[model samples]
Target: MAPVASPTLLARLLLAVAFAAAGVAAWAEHRADLARRAEGAAFAKRYSIDVRRPSFVETAKAEATGDLAYMPLVDAAVQDAMGTVALANLEPSARKAWIESAQELTAELAAARGLSLSGLAARPGWAYHAELLAFLTYTGDRRTAPVDLTAKSARWELPARMATRLSPGDDATWGFLAGAYLETWPRLPERTTAQALPILQRAFEDPDFVRRGFGAAVAYLGVEPAARLLPKTPDALRTARDIVGKRDVPAAARLHAIWETVERETREKDLARLEELAERGDVPGRRRTAEYWLVKHPPGEFDDENGRREVGRLVEAWPEGSHGPWPRDPRAQLVQHLLAGRLASVRGTALARLGNQLTGVPDSVRARLLLAAGDRYGWERILLESGGVGSFDWTRFFTELAARELAAGDAEKAEEALSRIARPARTECDVLLVRRAVAREAGKTAEEREAEAGLALAVEDRFGAERFAGGRTVSPCVDPERWADAALLVKVASPGVSLVGYGWDGGRIGTTLVSGEATLAVPLSGLSGRRSFSIATLAGPEARASEGWVTTSTGVRGDQPEAAQAAPLPPPPAP
Candidate 1:
């Protein structure tokens, strides 16, 4: 050592050096703070974000320490994330972290602001904050997100409570409340409906709120309850109707409103109002109302004066030229003309209308209309084309057509028309009458005899010979006793023609073969009731020709006839 120094001098020299270093560190921190402030100001100006508040400074300090109690932080973060590209450039983990922090901050701010009504009213920006919070809560991962204000644990009444603080004349506040409530309604607990009604009622009382299109929150309460909440005035009813008719409303709610309105209008006997609603075909609710009205008051028979008036009323009220698969069950088109007792006046129009329809028109109704219009060709075409199907009553149509053709002297066409009859058993007498006349007119004596005998069997089968003995159409050619025995005489014009006779009960009985001009008896005792007979030629030039007939016996005869009874014959082999 060159010179020993005193302890006080050495200590003073070290303290000076330490003080200098401390000053330099303090200066560096001050410059960093200044730079941060300047950068924040520039960001606020460039993005038009309002950060010129004490809360922003507090938010920065809290963010560093992981605290979230300020509202301005949420606003700034949302503005930055939504308005700038910086968020998109963030890495996935950083982006997630930023969003989570923002969500927690928003929840914290909403809960704090919602606790005091006076404070919420003093600051109108809280309304926007509540809206942002609702948006965030509803749009976030809803199951685990912290922002469900509607939850029982959360401040569920924040929006409604804020709405209550709004002055009666403050339309803007009312609109905000309604909009926020509407947005959050889907996630709201069902238990909240009672709580929400009062707030909604207050908001709707402001005309400007309704004018701003925020009055639609009524649907959240559902139809019946919502209807009870509305004013009973005509304007209010109309407004309710319009609101419910919007497509965004639930269909069940809309239908309920429509039906309730209809019931009220009908109960009050407000026909004009009801008709007005019915005519608005564009509104599905009103269209359903019109359909209900049509169904309840159907057009009765035209013979009654009251019924005719109803027809006229319905025709006038029909929503024509509108979107309709019209309820045509009442046959309104047909009855409308029949109301005036002027069938001729509507014949052409009826044909045109009926022609346009591919289905749904009854065949009998169309045919009668065609016949009335002297469109015989149309009637005949329908019968021929339908081929005894649908609602045409084809048996009757073919029978009538045949009789008409016979009277018109077109015997060939008459016979051809008769061939198309599906159930000849139903119209057997009518068919035989036509056939006998056709045969007599053609000078076929043998055919006329055969038809006369067939007619005799039919008459006896229907009305027993004892029931109408004198009025009988023809005498029985086959003895009544032989008929009971299921026996008949085969009298072919040519001899040695082979005949195969068949009987039917529930099923086909054994067949019997015999030569022509001989007595043929079938063992039909097993049959309980009347038996049917058919003869087919198995040999000779008339091979495979068949003729069917029914026996007039009401009971089976056990006694066998001592005639040339034929044994059961096997059918000819297939070719």
Candidate 2:
């Protein structure tokens, strides 16, 4: 493997400074420069709607810790470009071409960010003329040019509301290439976005670009990418209030993006990672910000858990004793939770409140959520909100999947039919989808759901005590004692040797295997009898202590066995 490039020393030292100084320095320096430039009658010279130097900005682009002498030159070039495009008297054909040229430069002006695009002239493929042709080809506009250009006003002049409608800028962000890819997005997705990206995102690691692209792709998909490329959108309006209630980016925006991706794909999309960064993440700045956003947003115990726990990190993060329900909260749970009491008592509060708040949410959308909830909670008039038969399960999202399998549509799902927990149950009793859907989601077949009660009973019998350790920072596995859900515990032991159940991925963190029967009986308690022991931490290979766990020893400790004197170390047995 090629050696990974490290971030520059200057970058590491000034990162935080860059973030802070970026604000005040920009304001002060720009203002001071504006004044000095104004003294030179810069407005008259720079504002020409006709200066046409496409190569001009190339000389002005900023170099790290470099002077800004080139900024004015670039600005003048842009003014000229915009002016060239603004010519109202130009023929429709020419104007159309100019509009095409103008769009590229104008896209960033409203965001008022990023360095000049002058360097594109250096590479013919990326050259301004080449890009303009591509844009025309991409958008399929046939209009020609004699175009008069104008100021950079139209892009940013939209009402804040309309501006919000713009899909996020991928190019201007930490994920520039990703954004660039989207900037040229064909209104309809083709084999390119779908097929090309998975390969590219895996090999690319320019941090600011690749990681961001990977994240944005995941965001658009509404699912977790490798369980690391997304962030938890805090549902607590108050928790997210600082961002939504206060700042521009809602804490939930990240999570919502992930959830939406998952909901839409509803398939377990897999990726082969060519590099690992989220773990030993070398990216920072806006890239770091994007990475942080990704890290904080995956759902809880959410394996369609046993039930997905109601995530409230944002709520939890909100300082205690804060006031008001942050109404605009992006979190579904937060919005639902805050509206809890306002609902009627008859139907379960979720449906009732949701029914009352139907306008805020869509009717079809409400139906889907309510119907799914009803699958577990039973029907009610509260669920019968006005003109609809809620869509929570419409298009047969869950059952249709099962129906397809029974209908013999998808063999992979049929082959992989196994009952794992669906979603974490909030309130220890939130509606759970016991049946239906995908090779990855729950993988239940008609047979599984038909046998849901029986299979679930068996599942409950075998692994009901299987709730694993839960938390954002906790390992994917957990301790033996922590395993409580029936789906988790199993029983077996030796004369005194019986074992209970075992945890799934959620359980079994920190556990190590020691010498035991060919089919190791999960010890109901610790390994019993004078058996050999093998052990290791959750992250590595299970080790063998010279001595095994017993009355005086920790199975893991190599030191003198503690009060739990463990059995002797297991000999390296036959492979």
Best by lDDT: 1
Stretches of candidate 2 off by over 4 Å are: 1-39, 42-74, 78-208, 211-302, 311-356, 360-575
How many steric overlaps does candidate 2 have? Answer: 95
Summing lDDT over every window of 10 consecutive residues in candidate 1, give the lowest-scoring window: 468-477
> What are the clashing pairs of model 1?
none
TM-score of each: 0.26, 0.22
**Deviation of model 2 at 403, angstroms:** 20
TM-score of 1: 0.26
Q: What is the lDDT of residue 258 in candidate 2?
A: 45
lDDT string, candidate 1, 356-409, tens digits? 332455565556456545678888677667644533265544555666777888
lDDT of each: 0.45, 0.30
Could you give candidate 2's per-residue lDDT for residues 253-293 as a string of tens digits? Answer: 44334444453232211110101222354333323332233
